[model samples]
Target: MSSAPIAAAPAHILELARRVLEIEAEAVRALADRLGDDFIAAVGLVLASRGRVIVSGVGKSGHIGRKFAATLASTGTPAYFVHAAEAAHGDLGMITADDVLIALSYSGSGEELLKIVPLIKRQGARLIAITGNPDSPLAREADVHLDGAIREEACPLNLAPTASTTAALALSDALAVALLDARGFGADDFARSHPGGALGRRLLTHVSDVMRSGPAVPRVAETALLADALMEMTRAGMGMTAIIGDGDGDRIIGIYTDGDLRRSLASGCNFSTARVADVMSRGPKTIHPEALAVEAAEMMERLRISQLLVADREGRLVGALNHHDLMLAKVI
Candidate 1:
């Protein structure tokens, strides 16, 4: 690697950054005051449409449009992004007569968007324009025009599209969220759309999917010796073993864990011949295998437990799980 001297500027970098944030924040805050009849119309139009919601824009506005489309798509609104330039290059065919198009153009005069707005309208697709100019051609052509007009830009030279883009993005979010609420979208719907993420796993994974069953569950009869419980726990590597009564239809008598072992040793109990029932703790916590894994995790966390037993309605042990099992399932 070659050593090079770093170049330094003489301006107050932090002050300029702060001023930019203040301007953008004010621009977005002003949007709430502008939520009039037009905003409502836009939301109703998208909600009532039989087809998808297509978000289109160019440059910085295109970036925001992509995020807006993704949010809408994940929140139960069928939506996707189409670049304005690409639309003019034949992507416009994707828009159908029953679809709703949300066009983002801060200046309301982007040539690429204006070139295709007429085609979209002629095809019977409704247009929702988000722009800083109300009287511009694109805004005039829209079925619903959302005025994102800002007094000043965040740029120091007042040339870059900073505050204007931020306002347009915030407006897009407002419209998408309004539509989401109108559709009665919930967390389950969101999780369904994001099944590969942690939120999805937490909500969709059931205890049965992660619990140890059959041969994997460390269990022993109440008549078994303390050494037997220890052997079962060691074989299963779960740090605990379930103790069940022999004549009581194998009904749970108690649970023997390392904690119980420690206490028994501290009490000077002889493990060589002592029964597991003598040292096991009774009335151990249990869970249903059909319950959500996250619920099990919550229960364990609330009770400060490292392991839990899974039983059916008849009180028969079906499975077992511990913190390590939960971690393996990515449910912790």
Candidate 2:
């Protein structure tokens, strides 16, 4: 006979889950209470270092170290990760005297780290240790030791690393945020670092970059017939046309759109004989070529309009764009 499997009740599983969360939350909260001069010193060390921060660790601590390096790098502090074992195998060349070393070890006694830390110190690089035990050799030798010690692991057996890693990650994030504030890193500065992202594109792409210009801009003389204006709008695919003063003049007298055409037809205007200037809307909303694309999107939304005329400093129609173009550019 085959033995039947046993399953824990839903209530029991839920209780276990809640207990794990509570333990982890307590571990993070305890970190704040433990902060003192050492936390401040860690922030100062990174802020004062002229070169990058070199983060090193082994096992689960190594994974947290990678996150620590990324957070610091993204938040205005230059940092990179080096595996503790790899450092012993010639990756130590990446470290320099000007750089600061941040080593992560929950037990403060990873053999690979022990082998690498001494060589790093010999190079004159300052050491900062994030460890669970302050009495460990790693903490004793570190110039500044961050106390990541927790009362116990969230694991029921207290053998697997759980609370300790969470405390270390949170503490490292605190250091990065403090250094970011000290550097006065702003949105513009972050955009420069991440120019390929959507936020960077929104901030850096100008109206002129995406606006239809030159012959693609639908334009007609103010005296042109409604039929002629409609032809230009259809050919340009912008759903609207700019009606400027006669004789190739640069001044935008008004704008005539598909909506205007509809209203004109509703009012019984003769499209064949009526002039564009006679029925077109005057004082149309306009944006400058130098403005950000995101600014143009905002203006269109606020006015409840679909298209905007791209004008120059002198108010001459230089280009044109509509909500469709903005959507295509992913700016809206």
**Best lDDT goes to which candidate?**
2
lDDT against the true structure, each candidate: 0.91, 0.91
> Where does candidate 1 have its weakest 10-residue lDDT segment?
5-14
Model 2 Cα lDDT, one tens digit per residue, 1-332: 75897798999999989998899999999999999999899888888888899999999999999999998888799999999999898899999999999999999988998888889889999999999999999999899999999998999999898988899999999988889899999887777777888888888889998999999999999989999999998999989999898865577879998899899989999989999999999988899999999999999999988999998877789999999998888887
Q: All candidates' TM-scores?
A: 0.93, 0.93
Give the C-alpha lDDT of model 1. Answer: 0.91
Worst 10 residues of 2 by lDDT: 244-253
| 117-138 per-residue lDDT for model 1 (tens digits) | 8899899999999888999988
Supply the TM-score for candidate 1: 0.93
Q: What stretches of model 1 exceed 4 Å from their correct place?
A: 1-11, 247-251
